[model samples]
Target: MSTDPRLFIDAPLSASAAIPLAREDAHYLINVMRRGEGDVVRVFNGRDGEWSAVIAHASRKGAGLTVADQTRPQQGVPDLWLMFAPVRRSKTELIVEKATELGAAVIAPVVTERTQSDRIKFERLQAITKEAAEQTERLDLPELRTSEKLAAVLDNWPDDRLLIFCDESGDEADAAWGGARGRGQPMAAALAGAGDRPAAILIGPEGGFSPAERDRLRSLQHVVPVTLGPRILRAETAAIAALTIWQSTCGDWR
Candidate 1:
């Protein structure tokens, strides 16, 4: 399996489609991977399913692969989104990678009162997600959205979609938020009967949501607040944990 490389192409994919590799991919395939003509590999675009392709042509500057047949048809996961406040650069990257692996349909950066940075390098994040999708054998890549204020996102919230809010201050015994999920409300219980309903998991920054922000989220009609556990988790850890819990209960993993 290691011999057969799986690559992600940004263009539409179909049988006999000539995929032109970028300079870096060309270098990796030819020099690093040490592949010759007639080698077979798998390729996919977010829009297209995975396909079997062969190296029809190779060169120093570039190599062209010919798409053969569809290995897996295009499939989408549960309409789950990850709305997180951006943290430090490396931790933010970790959140993106894990979210992709854990099956988030969309990844949007939300700016809360305690958000550390507003700048999001989509190019770098896109590359990381594509690499992660390829490595994790995911058919589709998670959509990345620009950073937006929490208030803006809430004001524009859709009526049909459910927002799973991870409030650090939530209590298992608290009457609010239906109590700690997976214990009182439980993550699975909060998501019960919500199959195919547009849902999102929101994680705040390291400093957590501000008092006003917490009140605002709690007051939202469509928001479902839940707790991770008794222990406090970092921003990145909470993001991954929330996605995993969602997938296991209501996403593709189920």
Candidate 2:
């Protein structure tokens, strides 16, 4: 494991150059971590890849760091996207955090008729993603798109990206119809055999997807309706469950 501390900031960094870290970051490093000058850290931009750096100056307001060398090149992410109807604020944040940790290439919010929360705090969600990436040692942040209507999302579905729709309508008697088993083979096993095509998992709202929405999703060739389980799961639980299955099957869980 790399000993360098991971920090996410928006400032530009260049080799052997000093860049001022953000105030919040500086506090976290100095006041929080009690680190002083010359301590090593790792940084990454969604665009510039990852780099090794050392603290040059520390202050109460902020700190400055000098880039030492590039550590890892930007890595290619999985072709998986996570789309879900917005739920409550705290759970929504959890979903974003877990999705990032699970290696979702994109995090999209789809507004369905049953969606409980129409508004999302983008900044808060972004912060959750950043924190998750930092802790999980991920170099890239998932692309977060604004919420769109479910109908609109279906209308613009990419032809090649398979949509794994988590539905609740399957027969309880069938093992395949309930829980993670129906979601497909374990995420790791599925991804090992999967080609380069991108895929997405769609999670509905608290009240679940409307019957019409389910029918529409089933009708789409790109959408594959699958069940999470026989027992009803909360919106947030379903999102995490689906993501866990996908990551374990086809993403970084392996």
List TM-scores for all candidates, in order. 0.91, 0.87
Q: What would the per-residue lDDT of candidate 2 be over residues 86-156, giving only the tens digit for each residue?
A: 88888888889888888898999999988889799998898888888888888888999898998998888
Cα lDDT, model 2, residue 218: 62
- lDDT comparing candidate 2 with the true structure: 0.79
Question: How does each model score on lDDT?
Answer: 0.83, 0.79
Candidate 2 positional error at 87, Å: 0.9
Candidate 2 TM-score versus the reference: 0.87
Stretches off by above 4 angstroms in model 1 are: 1-3, 170-184
- Candidate that scores best on TM-score: 1
Worst 10 residues of 1 by lDDT: 175-184
Task: Give the Å shift of residue 198 in candidate 1.
Answer: 1.1
Best by lDDT: 1
lDDT of 1 by residue, 136-200 (tens): 88888999998899999998999999999887654422544354332224567788887778899
Q: RMSD for each model, in Å, please?
A: 3.1, 3.9
